[model samples]
Target: MFPKHVRTHHRLHHGHKPEELDFLIRRESVSGGATSSQMQREFGRLNEEEKENLLKGVGLRPGIPSGAGLLLKANLALSWNKLRHLRRWLRNWNVSLDSESKDREKAKGMTSPLVAEQLPFTFTVKGPDGKLATEVRLASCVCLEDISSTVLQRLDLLEREGKLTWHGVIPSDEIWLKIGGDKGGGSTKAVFELCNVAHPNSIENTIVWNIFQAPDRRHNIETAYKINLSQINALCGTMWK
Candidate 1:
């Protein structure tokens, strides 16, 4: 016999299974009908009586106030085959993680910026020529991961003769970077810890080493910078309390 939970949710038999049929029927109801080929197949397997029950809205309330419909959809969303989205999630997604308000004027008048206003800071990467390979900066936040990608790109490591072998990142103690004067890559912190930078302003300007400068650690490319942090700036008026 199938596990108790599995038996409660699904059944393989073609005979009338009220629990299983109700699940698929209710999915289509809140979802405005089957949206995909797989869904259409599962829906077609339902008995005529089940279809009739859905048409009569047997287990649902009318339109927007349909509390039962909301609960059913929420349950289905957690299933292996996600049936429908929670109504509030759809609303937030359309906001673009920015803002809603179709009226531009209302958005403009609001104090909150659509996306976080990223503070700009710069990094100087030295090329193979030992000169400025590229200048990298984020429109806002700065962290170890961000710097790694930027450093690799700015140094043109992709086009370089050597591939970045994943020997493993060096211990944070061996590789050094500063957010500001004495504020970066603490003596005890590791690269994993450095990745969680609290603020962008922490790494405004730092000199990244050329491979030649650290020949022994060249193969371990990810952690070769000797960065220094002078001032650590957190978001104004937006910091979490």
Candidate 2:
């Protein structure tokens, strides 16, 4: 149970009903098992909104999120917020890259026309433990299948170099690109644009790429497809840590 001053603080700041606030304080007290001094220290760390939520509670009456759960949720929210910011940054980067590419193309004129439609992008492959396995530059203007193949080839090389190791065979079909930030679907044109934006120096230079290995299940592979660049950036922002 909370002290009189704590109750007054809740009433003053949160305006929660007395009975409701009492219930939440009791629940949190049981879940946290903190001394009064510890509680004060923890409470002091919370911002105004968090302090209000702590008193008012979350979810149902008895099912309020525990301190640990609240901490996890806060971390997740922070990560998502960072991801959103990264998405904005990537969008700006893409626009800048496009402008530069156009200027270079105009400068070259008809004398040095690009021979092949090469889409160079940076590839970042993560192992099963959510660690970076390898990162490389690849140039290809092809379908998703071809892109997956190229990524797999790089993974194979890394595995041989002892940079990456797998539990069992990571089938080529199980290897896929999580383009942009989406997990379900992506297209060649989107990949081309993303690569072009991320690799403005040369269409043959590397652009941002994310390689993920799906579960061994057939359904997972079937559902996997290319995703948008913003989505990829968002995913990277979240998963990189």
Give me the candidate number with maximum lDDT. 2
Candidate 1 per-residue lDDT over residues 1-241, each given as its tens digit: 3233333334432465788676655554544543366566666888987764664564442243323333343334343123233434544332111122222344244222222223323445798889985443433322332334343342343226343222355443232223322223322122211221222222222322221122122222233333211112111122211
Q: Candidate 1 — what's its lDDT?
A: 0.34
Model 2, span 1-241: residue lDDT tens: 4544344345433767779766657745554534466668768999987875665564322222223322332345434345445435544433111233342354454121122333434445897999986443434432233433344454455456654322254443232233332233332222222121222233332222333332222332223333323334443333210
The parts of candidate 2 lying over 4 Å away from their true place are: 1-5, 8-13, 28-241
Candidate 1: C-alpha RMSD after superposition = 19.6
Tell me each candidate's TM-score: 0.17, 0.17
For model 1, the superposed segments whose C-alpha errors exceed 4 Å read 1-118, 122-126, 129-135, 141-241
Q: Supply candidate 2's per-residue lDDT for 154.
A: 44
Give Cα-based local distance difference scores for all models.
0.34, 0.39
